[model samples]
Target: MNRPTYNLLWRLAMPLVLARLWWRGLRESGYRKHWNERRGHYGARGAGWHTLWIHAVSVGETRAAEPLVDALMALYPNSRILMTHMTPTGRAAGHELFARHGDRFVQSYLPYDTVSKLTRFMRHFTPRICILMETEVWPNLIAVCKTRGITVALVNARLSERSLRRAGRFGRLMTQAAAQLSLVAAQTERDASRISSLGAPRVVITGNIKFDVAVPAAALARGRFLRQRINADADGDSGGAGRPVLLCASTREGEEALILDAFKAMPERPPGMLLLLVPRHPQRFDEVANLAGLRGLRVARRSTLGQDGADLDSAVEVLVGDTMGEMVAYYAACDCAFIGGSLLPLGGQNLIEACAVGKPVLIGAHTFNFAVASDEAVAAGAAVRVVDAAAMLAQARQLLLDTMTRNSMGAAAFGFAAAHRGATTRTVELLQGLIY
Candidate 1:
């Protein structure tokens, strides 16, 4: 399909899309709050021109864009950035991330990918450059930007074999979109090759920007305090004196049930071990908590705990991390971390954060989303890949009991994270060439 066909299909589906957004708003009100922006009607709020515009669709993309955003801000001191998102969660994450910058960093919901809406967005923002984080290559969006003389870059880009196959189904629509990109700073050579196959004319290997993201000092301190609270001993002297914590971070929909069942079925669990379950989506926090309770496991929510987790019950078997923007803290607090979304075929969530926090990492078989990182991390002795939830827990049990191996893996994980730094700097340099 070509641009015209894609646009016609998009226009036809706009009503269904709006209805879905409205339905999602019932669970997450942020979706409903920015209705006008969805229609490309920013009005007076979007009056000024931006130097750079970034489209980071959701939370993962938003978070991945953080270091690159900072680098861009530093490189262009007086420039304004227009951040766009497709999800309320991404918008919220961006707002929290760049809140200190005030008006210099503006955010809006990306307009629908039709010619008119895309044209309106481009006219309103008047951004000289558009940087799309990860795999966001909308046909109409790219076509409109190119026509309007906007330099579009797909930075920190990645493409898995599975994604390539899916994109192949769209044929010319995907190829034309990729061909329109001025640059694609891919995370790996494999990604560059895959993107090249999709017809991106200018692809470069700039590594993964996520490795360059700095762990906030405050997050580490918070992690220490949380660890103390989570591991409070029998006598209440909370100085790393309690049970070992196994953090199941960024777990997806079906993986939680598998993990919970595995945890319950473990015949030889580590003595006084606590499971810290953090779901990937905020809307499913209550659902996850209920899942734990239904399994007869004593569950406690992070949201209900006091400022320092003072009200945390000592007898709790599972701790549900229901908060947002605290992934670093969660990683730092855990003894070992299991990266989720991989147990099934859902592609894995980011395991780099856990490694950055110097924790032993556990991943599942499916990690195509982060294929290079996962394989390299496992090869570096920083991470171990298990086949399923049972294997994950079994491995976790062994790691929890073996302190020496765990500590060694933790050190390797930190080293692995440090070794892959400077992607942001490289990407910024390339972007500078485009701007000039």
Candidate 2:
């Protein structure tokens, strides 16, 4: 009912959590890679120099942290950053994202929320300040940081209605945990209100940091090359001439079946239409590829391609994007993008990246995870939200069939992305007051 009780329960659940991790490691090896780090026994690597730390839980959060990380690196010229992630995907993404600045950044798993581990982690890092990206709320971590006089802030903070309901189950603990946050830079007024209701002391609307993600020039170039290759293949193969590529980005479990079913039912798709199905979790990559194959589509895995190569066969109906850290490239290589996880009640995946790359975007009905951005994008003529798989397929067909409409939507997508660009700046300014 309160912090103490919650802490005790969490401790009791530790074994089950470890067992879950072990089971997950059976599928995803990353869960098994850094057992000690998760337990707060960091050994020599934990003995760090710089005190500034940023906690990004998974791949999405890690990618969103990029611009903020860049800003932090610039703001603190001589200091090193200790980046933390809960998932191995996030850890890998952190390394890939900051590979050039290897010496300036450190990546590891944030310790499990327990007193002993929290104490050890704090003593090891001695962090001056910590930035919690998105909604990574660990009561023990926050309480310990507050006790140690470490500034803890949540950047690009958001609270979906569903998340708020879940947090309400432990209202007292959540309120206490939230109250300790030095700052809550929320992405929207709705988020600010919910976070405030949860007892976050200082909440400010800073928009979503994801709007500031820059599509690398190399990604765009590679995307263009891949498109050209597809076009070349189409030209050579009469069976596949003049088709468009549609990317279904970050699809969840049940949604893939619907998408594949709709695609199969559509007998009059464009001449050589290709569907790029990218599931949200790496563990589902093989399963999704299998789904595509079972649907009688000629499926190819993106992982099989050589570096910067797009030697896909003309007969391929669907391409399974089984690779990591190249989402922007997938968006750029497509004529239109569909934001996944929304077809069911799955609270949609981020569509900001698709818009940032100047692609016309589509989404399913549910998008509460990115509610404001999705609504605004549709209002701005940059995105289309369909109620079901059939609707999504129809919209995708229209976009592929109508070049003028798609081009206009793409232009609007760029403008919409550009209009929401100052979140990173606002976030950095807020953190400056706390740390600088």
Candidate 3:
């Protein structure tokens, strides 16, 4: 409804939220360790004012913010950044990503969206600018920032038709939150229009920053090593001739069952073809591994393998990528990649990473979260959209068998990624303008 009602509702829900957080900590202990931060409490303030504060809700948002973060750091060399997150995974990723920066980059859990909590956070950090990654427009957070003279910008913002419809249910609350944004650097014109519909006053088409993410050299080296391990024959002879790897990256809960079933049902399956299944969440890694094993597919975990992957079983049919921050490595190691979270209408994971590594891309029909990218990628012959898991496997079969076709698609994928590489530059310019 309105701001006051929203705040009241949030206050009422805090207990339940804390309970959920504690429950999640049973699986991921990081949630249990950040109680004070979640409640807007922090230790003694020792540092100077943070130049910029960024709120990235979870892992995907945190990862997507990497290039923009780099650009911001380069532009404002003297300034420090305060990164905030809602999930432990996001915090961990932020820590890993900016660990090189040391104290210049600080992270904390974003407090609940209430005036008091946000005010405390504002007072503690005293950041001049608030940059929200993607679709994180909290009403109280925006209102509090505005009152404290903090310029709020929504960068690399996107809004799907489905999301718009959902936001419409909140009516004025969502509209007011959007209207408070100083700028919205949208990924596409459609996103800008949708955000505008939600009353964002200053929306700009700055493209998607994810396309600008540099493929890490370390990741490439790891990929090469993994490829060597994956390609080894049963006799322990590592060579160029080996199993074809089909990476199902960022797969969600229900989608894994469908994918496993489809893999099992595939007729005339290629000899020594491996399924590299990487689930989107860490909590479900064991669940996915068990699912593969229950289907009679031999599974090996990436975590169990040594640093060199020397212990990777040659006869393993499925390799569970249980590790974090190695998506690019997985992409580089795979011959073909199926970007997950789309098959069952969960709005799709990022396919851009796989494309950046010059791999043939396979996606599902429900890519509304990445609507423009998915459509343009398919149009550019860099990706193919399948309607179901069965179709996904079928296309993977064709791509795995046809070396020339796969190579052509890989080339196109790399070209597509290269052509959209300046979003970070544009976004940084906009942020500079906002700050000045």
Task: Give the poorly placed runs of model 2, Cα more than 4 Å off.
Answer: 45-48, 232-242, 306-310
Question: What TM-score number comes out for model 1?
Answer: 0.96
Q: Against the hidden true structure, what lDDT does model 3 obtain?
A: 0.89
Worst 10 residues of 1 by lDDT: 232-241
Clashing pairs in 3: none
All candidates' TM-scores?
0.96, 0.96, 0.97
Q: In model 2, which residue pairs have backbone atoms overlapping below 3 Å? A: none
Q: For model 3, how does the per-residue alpha-carbon lDDT over 67-154 read when each residue is reduced to its tens digit?
A: 8888788888888889999998999999988989887899999998889998888888889999999999999999999898999999
**What's the lDDT for candidate 2?**
0.88
Q: Model 1, 1-436: lDDT tens per residue?
A: 7767877888889999999999999998888997988898877745454469999999999988889888888888888888999988899999989988877899999988888888888778888899999998888888888898889999999999999999999999999889899999999999999999988899999999999888999988777777777754422222245777899999999999999999999998877788999999999999999999999999998877667537467689899999998899888888889999899898899989999989999999999999999999999999999998999999999988887888899999999999999999999989999984
For candidate 1, give the lDDT.
0.89
Q: Once superposed on the true structure, which residue ranges of model 1 sit more than 4 Å away at CA?
A: 45-47, 232-240, 307-311
Model 3 poorest ten-residue lDDT run: 231-240
Model 1 per-residue lDDT at 144? 87
Give the RMSD in angstroms, all C-alphas superposed, for model 3: 2.3
Q: Which scores better on lDDT, 1 or 2?
A: 1
Per-residue lDDT of 393 in model 2: 85
